[model samples]
Target: MVLKNILHHRFFENFLKYRYLLTELVKRDIKVRYRRSVLGIFWSFLEPLLFMIVLTIIFSTLFSRSIENYPVFLLSGRLVFMYFSQSTNGAMRSIKMNSPILKKLYVPKYIYTIALTLSALVTFLLSLIVLVMVMLATGAPFTPYIALFIVPTVLLTVFNIGVGLILATINVFFRDMEHLYGVFLTLLMYSSAIFFPPDVIPVDFQWILTWNPVYAMISLTRDLFLYGQMFDTFTLIFATISAIASLVIGLVLFYKYQDKFILHV
Candidate 1:
């Protein structure tokens, strides 16, 4: 009975009640993102494709000997990092961005962060079409392992939501967080080995790649999609732990401080 009551608690009730609003918020975010753009949603398809082309052109001579089908390798890692970067950034700004509606309404504050992340997820999924096209064009073989790509994708999304919640909570208090996080993301992108291979890192620094959840996810996807193999046990275990820990920490902080958000925002 206690579990049942908890399951249907008013918190969950509010989510169900406001579910429609969440859907509208996600739609609005996507529409507003491309509002004045020429190609609008198609940019989702083109942006990653263009980025992959440029990176392949620039780095092909340097790393092509080490990485086979370099375009696929680069695109797989780039897409995962791009989603993490975009989703987390959007979620960080979500609370402040929707302050006007928040002040006048009683909707759950976390909804804004979730809507932003989901919108980014929608964009990321669309970009995968470009990944598929590149894979076929480059003659990267499709294997049954490709289906396992969903495992890392789901874990990465959970990790993003967790990190997004924490960032949103902090950003509410510190306006400078926006700029600071941009710098951190730049560092993170470099550390993720998106454009380079793990072997490029010195032997002493290999643990940086091993412990980095973002890189773990990227490497996992690359294993499935590019290399046609299952991800190693350590990467899977570490990524799972990282994702769950982030979510737990993010939830604890966000809920503990959420009531104070209106004062700061």
Candidate 2:
């Protein structure tokens, strides 16, 4: 297949052209995130910790028995929320943020964004360590099923890569996309089941929550970490399809418009 050959060559070519740059970009991103800071990487844990504590107080004291193990409940949402939010935001800004290099050098447009995605992955790994610790400390049961989260985690990574590609490419032309993405991501965060349980939502709204692709990731996370069980077959199939669709659309957009990107910027 001619398409397959092009992809094969493209993959090998980009692998050679951008791999080292990606590595460096990831390192720089990590350093910049913690540069001149006392907490350094420890600060990665702070957001969820603070959020979990506040939510625990509100849910346990204020709501009074809305859910058991409120910290665990919040952690489920927080983990996936942090990953999706950071990856998408980072990716959306990737191309424009690397304008200097983009203009002077010949590199794949997707690399700039992948660099950001990889950077976020590094931080995600670091934060996941704290997540595991918090889970153990909170007396949540750990089992082999916990490994199941890795599937959706990988799916979410691919999903972000696709999202980043589309946004980064559009941002090169529209420019306002950067600001727009921030607002959209904020809406996405609240709509995601991060702070609220889906069951508490109205029956009419419950399907929306379950049907939301992001909610699947968050709910699967809760299932694995909070309940230590895999979701039913339908949910997994739907999530995989959604993730793949996003990837196909994103790559198509990136390839279609990438040639004009340099001129746009």
lDDT of 2 by residue, 85-122 (tens): 78778888877778788899887778778878878877
Q: Which stretches of candidate 2 lie over 4 Å from their true place?
A: 1-7, 62-66
After superposition of all CA atoms, the RMSD between model 2 and the true structure is: 2.0
lDDT of 1 at 109: 89
* Tens-digit per-residue lDDT, 58-80, candidate 1: 99889988999899999999999
Which 10 consecutive residues of model 2 have the lowest summed lDDT?
60-69
Model 1 CA lDDT for position 244: 97
Native-structure RMSD, model 1 = 1.2
Query: Which candidate has the top score in TM-score?
Result: 1
What overall lDDT, based on C-alpha atoms, would model 1 receive against the true structure? Answer: 0.91
